[model samples]
Target: MPSDVDSTADEQSNGYWFRRGLAGIISAPAFILMASFVGFGGLAREAGWSAGEAAFITGFIWALPSQVVFIGSVAAGASFGAIIIAVALSAVRLLPMTVALMPILRDPKRPGWVYYPASHFIAITAWVVSMMRLPDVPRGGRLAFFLGFGMSLTVCNVAVTLLSHQLAGTVSPVIAAALVFLTPMYFLVALWSAARMRADYLALITGLVLGPVFHHVDPEFDILWAGILGGTLAFGLHKIMERWS
Candidate 1:
């Protein structure tokens, strides 16, 4: 349907694609992300964050993991420098995501500075959706579509965070915690659905196997080490298999 639409005169208009992208909010991933942020709002309240602070973090950071690390660190009375380091470490994963996404969204006619703000929207949800959807869109309209989807999602979630913060006390801790798991579940399922290569499957499986092992070894940096080691091993194995083939 997108390919059919792209072949028409609407292909030339950014506004058309942008408005179409706005429809992403109605999708499953969007709902999952909103639910996760509701959980985040409850977590923030339990951590003693103000509603304004929670909303600000949601708007600016936009990465749920980083927001969690930030609030967790602050609540635990970590030093300012330590909080910054922890959050930055948690968010470093986004750099590669942005790099992977830029080729699809970049318009050579536009200046590079335009991508800087767009980069802020490069969380897991936006990146996953854009990677799947942008190839079908005309190159000229990809940025507009992404901006429409990402900006709208971010705005809506910010409001959700604020509202959830106000109603945080009403939600039982167990349910709120369960809500937070929905995003990762969606992410795993989406990745599986989108996988096209053996290497992709290998990487995912390796990460899954290593995650708990690394957690048992060192809880503080489990995710970081698991991801790095698992991804590197998968990549190396893929290369070896390719050479043998």
Candidate 2:
């Protein structure tokens, strides 16, 4: 009977991962990215780029913010050197995100080279969802789950970029452009579910409340200031709560 019970549990674990991995393929953020791609496609078309350039940019650049900066700089008649600098600056946020996420997703035995390809999938949407869900995932299944989730988003991104290029000329640019805002909106909702610690929750709330205010004062440096202020306050509040408890 004990052997039979063990077998049943194993089967259940397998089924759980199978279903969970499949669920990642059609996750909410995938749709969010699809909507955002419509805007990217529109931007490419508006820039008078061909569908190939749109596809290449989505596939190669991958980061939406960098892509947006590239488009904007080119449209404004910026020099090539300035465009490169702006796009690189827009992507500076990724370094910290990569640092935070790699340990959670990496397998010690898996060679470093594997991460080269895998790193491509570490976009904000995937990282946010993966960080939140990875603890619940069986350790061995984490990579498989992320590959499925990340691949789905990437494939959808490429497809939508190509399709958007054609549709951008015909579709309402304003509506599609507005959809790009969905990424941050979803981040707010996702953070609500994912925040477990008081410090984390407080930090998130502070960022949300003060983010627009800081941006109003200084759009260029708002994120850095908000992060510093929110993080410091959250740490202090958490320490106070711990001492009181």
Candidate 3:
């Protein structure tokens, strides 16, 4: 068991290093989204929000869809509470992701102060790939590996965001669309590769089918309900399949 664990840790550490480099390359498209934000921010400048406020939302919110929703909804005369709720609902997907990741990326021996800053590096795309690769890593080194990998991605994201703001006009819309697509494309591929077990496969299918269906019914609650109800259903399905076999 100990030997197996050690091997797994080595694999995970190596995997993280490999993926971290790939992530940097794949994440180049995200620069286009950054450019889009700068353009939008420029437009918003005259509407009411100051440049700092625009930059803050772009930087601190960090979630593109939610940031767009918040800014657009407010611009359209939505109440503050509604805007907040919209953003919160959009980000609710992070909760399960965080739960699923904590064990894999956590160092039980380390204090909270370390993980506190480390958690900032966690993002949807990175979390998905990291989770997929983590099982091969040993528990002891997984957290440190993630810290290095995630920090790399974060630095790239920030640098791109700042660059986009400074050179928004230089980026074409086609390139921006491509960049925005990179995150999801990477995630979809990683999620597909990670579905090695029945439960995970069912969860993926359930989430995919339910995401759009629930979105049409109620955009705000779709992710939460899909993750909860679909996940539960998938779990039950997996158990039944196992029993039958």
Give the TM-score of each candidate: 0.74, 0.65, 0.54
lDDT of 2 by residue, 30-91 (tens): 77667767767877777878999989888888888778778767876767876777677668
Off by over 4 Å in 3: 1-55, 112-114, 170-245
Q: Is candidate 1 or candidate 3 better by TM-score?
A: 1
Candidate 2 or 3, higher TM-score? 2
Give the Cα error of residue 202 in candidate 2, in Å. Answer: 15
Tell me the tens digit of each residue's lDDT in model 1 across 1-245.
44334334644688887887888999988987887788788778878889998899999999987888787667766678767777887788688788888988887767999999778888988888999999898777888899989998999999999998888676677766665555467557756875767788888899889988986997655656776788889889999998999
* Positional deviation of residue 204's Cα in model 2 after best superposition, in angstroms: 14
TM-score of 3: 0.54
The total number of steric clashes, by the backbone 3 Å criterion, in model 1 comes to 0
Displacement of the residue 193 alpha carbon in candidate 3, Å: 11
lDDT of 3 by residue, 1-245 (tens): 23136443454465555455445435434344344444444334434665556566655666655665576567656567766766776677667778888877765556767776667656555676677666665666666567666655555545554554444345676755554445455445656774668998898899889978877886655555776788889999999999999
Clash-forming residue pairs, model 2: none
Residue 195 lDDT in model 1?
73
Worst lDDT 10-window in candidate 2: 1-10
